[model samples]
Target: MRRLMICSFLLVLAATANAAQPIRLGLNYPSTGNYKSEGLELRRGALLAIETLNRQGGVLGRPLELISRNTAAREEKARANIEKFAAEGATMAFGGATSEEAIAAGQRARELGLLFFPTLGYANAITGHDGQRYLFRETNSAWMSARVLGEYLSWHLPNRRYHYVSLDDNWGHSMEQALREATRSRDRARHGFSRISARGARHEEYLAALKKAASSDADVLVIVLLGQDLVQTMRLAHDLKLDQRMQIIVPNLTGSIVEQAGPQVMEHVIGTAAWTWRVPALVKSEQGQAFVDAYIAQHQRYPDSTAASAYAIVQQWAAAANRTGSLHSEKIIKALEDHRYSLLKDEQYWRSFDHQNVQSIYAVRVRSRSEIMQDRFKQDYFNIIHRMDGEAAAPNLDEWQEERGDELSLR
Candidate 1:
């Protein structure tokens, strides 16, 4: 009888200990799709952060573990992934390589009442009309990118005629609208506009479409494509000698693109990035240098903007959970909203109203091969044109709310 009681007590203790095991962090990214490279980078960044946090004894006496799924960049797949995460007892979830997937994940997050951080989904609606208290965006929105890029364009090439080659999607439309609004006062005339399908279009099709846009008499050609499409467009432009015809402005640029395209193809391209591995201000900072070094040591390549954002998101969430002393959704949300931390360049915080992380936006110009090779930092492939303040770069959500009236539902 004594042995039986002792065994029962020990079993209960073991069960309780097992129940208090590591906190599971869920990630849903398209591991096998058009955005696979970006998704892999996101995973790498998140894993690196988790590894570092665990090495430091993790947060609140609990080590962190990551459980990831492939979303395939599909909305339904994203929703299903979110449900799976919730079912798997994830403390919090983060992912969404594309805006469409992010938006879908955001909607599901609201339904699940789980804390979600969407990394590298630049659509404004993720935090705009589709925003819920459970959803927080860790990437720059279309409006933010447009505002910064527009201001730069107006200042540098004012009164120039412009042509637009945009992707036929919500993100592309949002970017186009924001750019039009931002450059309204400038003496600009739309010389031409072409919308390309983002869903697996042939390279020859894109090349032909771009050739038409490049044939325009505009002083600048704005390419609003992402991922391999952007790479293909730039390469096609180079092949067609479009780069020599007019200034190419890529509103939504990332370090991965610059790396993939190389300095020769990317030379003289002006763009805005939420974050970049080569930003001098970031590289010079102690925290930034540590992140870059750690990322390189782990992955053997410098981290891109998406990777940086993913890592920052995980670190920020861990910090918030640690500070609040709980993984509860409400507590984490409150903690994240109130927290201000410096991960990259300047101090950044999640805006209480919209839950968008207000961080510096880099206006970068891709350097020539010669310039990059001569630079001290191997990743210094960009000439930092300007560091747009986070607050200034972000659109006025209050005004946006006022404009939307009752349509804007954030809760």
Candidate 2:
């Protein structure tokens, strides 16, 4: 009897050891640079998703473990991180805070034949010009935001002349081009524009750009900047009285920006976001409410757009893998493409043609302190003005691919 008991104990120990081995998922984001706040929120969201999945039996009965690395918004660093993740036996990876880094990582991912999911990068090239079979985007593109917002602005403020001031980067250029194309057909849409490189630019340069936009005859000034640069530009624009002179619009607005810039600075500013915590549709949904509640309960703060997006992406990936009952990249990819999931306020699906997640885009107007205090969502600030359907918002994938056939080729 004693020998039999000892053998049973040894067998149990072996099973426990095998069960303890987790399937690693690599994550690289800008954890220590200018975009650290966004990165931290992303990590929090992804971690929360993993935790939830683990608590619910995990994917394919194997625990999912996150292996994180700080890319500092650098391309080479992101590339190295992907290689390290592959070397460390990570089955799949997610990250890329900036489009440049995301593109670099996508190239490396294809070379390594590793599945890569970009969470927050908005450059069209990731899924357009530089897309690979291994790369899938879980975030909205600059073109989507621009198309939706541009069409709305052209119709709503048809007579209002427009000018643009954007950061001189891949994202900024893509946004500018998208908006331009969307509004070009409208009467009185043409206006002067200025682009400033976010890197190594002097104060005078920023001031000059602001002054140039301020001096333009346009009534609406579209500022295509992100992170600290967006905040800095807003502050200087206020100082130069540019904000007061022209109606300022930010194409890519996030909750963190409103918190960082304060309600006062954001007051009267109009913008569009990929997602916001205050959407009435989201607040009313069962899944969305649970996610918000769990996030606030765990993090002691509301999840921003970045956090929500990252969380959704992780959950989507896990669900797809579980549905397919396989961790193989090809199987997972098949499960994701054309897969419909309801993680947010609206039902979303992965478009097979472009690998872009299709969901509603919100146009928001930042409310003043008085307005926010009186609202039902007292903690939330923005009033969602419009919700654009994802299909209408997305660019024509067929045309886009045909125009850039060679560019989109994996070879």
Candidate 3:
């Protein structure tokens, strides 16, 4: 409990007059719609963090509290939620299942004088072209995932034809483009493309897309879908026997998604994650392990990357708030920018330029059904194949400058 409460974010929390009061933290997540799995994880993680913090002592001597709003994976809903949070006196709000939603939330939070931390959104634009002073992305970007996954694919698959079934949203666009550039699949004719609706697609829609992919001569099927959408599509792909015909590539993978789709559907699938439940053990992170233990004790299962991200955001933000002894955007931002610490997996840092928390990206492969079933909880899914350091995996200054253009300047 002490390990969980006393994280790297706040080494010492100063006492205050209104210490008995509670500090509200807002969360904008998709509790309904396609990304509900991720949303539940966020809620579970946030609650856990709040419980732990309150158990010992909340940040700045005030109890941390979560005030969440359901975005349902929509940008408009996300924007509205931020407005509500600000009106409700939430000092900070963080959460978003999609990049578009995150961008909307963050922008609105900036206007409302509330800092926004996006926990799961992965578009390059979230921290690049669309970045604002009040927003910080706690997750890895599309470019970071592509950088490592592409390197592995180059050595393993090499010169392969591809087909992309992408979510028609901000995250999907950046992911596909980044992966294409990294893998040298710039030629349109060489690879097939099918854009699926970001909102839950109908059965017929998925059937049409997967059938086209099934007929294509592509050696790999890149799925840029997540949550329930991913579960439904993978089941459809399996029914069509597409999994056996070609290798499947999901840009991002979480234990929640795999558990929903089952081990058989996700078996041998390739992807990347910022942190997995198994990662803490691999990196010898006692704090991370304590988090995992607490989660398992409460939920009777292992926590996924979404949960890990949410917990990190809550703890880190609280720590920063305590460090500056204020919830004002300017002070908290200064405390977090260029902040470095070992959390969850490895040495991760909040970069000043783009406000992205850079960390190691692990290229993972789903274990076989037999192997997965052998586990007591059946959540030991990912086999970490390749680990890329944050410094190398993330985009360089030149790339950031190109994306931000005149909106950014050298310090």
Candidate 4:
């Protein structure tokens, strides 16, 4: 009788301990698709953060475990993966490499009532309409980046005639609209916008269009396309002898683009971004250096925007979890609203209204390998293009309610 009672007590204690374990976090990303490289890097960064957090004794005294799923950059795959994650008891999910995939994932997440953190999808649909309760994007929206680029162009290159060659997708369209509005508000004649599909062999057609536009006296070329598309487009432009004819500006060019296009094609191309692998000494605070060093050590390579976003987001989640002492959605959300934690030295803090993290912008001009080797690089992108105040970045609740948000019935 005594042995039986002791065994039963031990079993109960083991069960209780198991039950008290920290909840698992689900990470959905494109692990086997066009953007698989970005996904792998992002996952590596996320794991680095998670490992660091756990080493520091984790949240609520229980170590965190990740439940990862791959989307393959396909809508059907993403939807299926989402369901799989949900069924596997994931409290939340984070994803969005491409615009279409991200939008679909966001809409589905909202429909399923899961808290989804978007890493690097620039589409506006995620947080555009009633994105308060479920969706939290630590990344800047397409509008945010577009507005910054517009303001910068207005100030610096006011005399130059700007022609836009943008990707014809949700992300590109939203960004184009924002850029168009901003440019038109300043001076309509200075800027013009055009569309191009990032996928397929539309390069010659687009190049011909660009050539015609240039012939009409367009001076500056602003390209809004993905890394792969940008590589192809730039190569085509270079072959056509069009690049040397115009000043090129690429807003969302990644390190991967440079790697793809090689040193030759990327030269003289200026880009705006949220983060980079090369951290300048002037901007390298202890925290920033630590994050950079940690990432490099873990991944055995330089960190890009995708990696930075994933790491930053995980840090954000950890901070929120630690502060709240609970992984529950409401508590974590409230903790994020406080914005008291320092996720990184980049000052990438979250906004309460829209739940978007307002981070600093960097303007980088592609340099030759020899120039890069000489370490003669400017740390700041464009001498502080725009310090987007979080308050200004905050979307109006009433305005959001009017635009499809009001109709969203999230029960």
Best by TM-score: 3
**Regarding lDDT, does 2 or 4 come out ahead?**
2
Candidate 4 segments whose C-alpha is farther than 4 A from its true place: 1-8, 15-23, 130-132, 185-193, 198-209, 278-284, 374-411
lDDT of 1 at 87: 92
Residue 337 error for model 4, in Å? 2.1
Q: lDDT tens digits, residues 224-291, model 1? A: 88888888889999988888888998987777777777778989899888776655354467777788
- In model 1, which regions exceed 4 Å deviation? 1-20, 185-189, 278-284, 374-379
Worst 10 residues of 4 by lDDT: 376-385
**Candidate 2, 93: how far from true, in Å?**
1.2
**Model 2 per-residue lDDT tens digits across residues 160-260:** 77788888888888887887777672343457778888575667777888888877788888888887778778888878777677888898887778777
Better of 3 and 4 by TM-score: 3
Ranking of candidates on lDDT, top first: 3, 1, 2, 4
Q: How well does candidate 3 score on lDDT at residue 189?
A: 81
TM-scores of the models, in the given order? 0.92, 0.91, 0.94, 0.85
How many backbone collisions does model 2 have?
0
The per-model lDDT (C-alpha) reads 0.81, 0.80, 0.89, 0.68
- Per-model C-alpha RMSD: 2.6, 3.1, 6.6, 3.7
Per-candidate clashes come to: 0, 0, 0, 1
Q: Candidate 3, residues 173-209: lDDT per residue as tens digits?
A: 9999999988888777879889999875898888899
Q: Higher TM-score: candidate 1 or 4?
A: 1
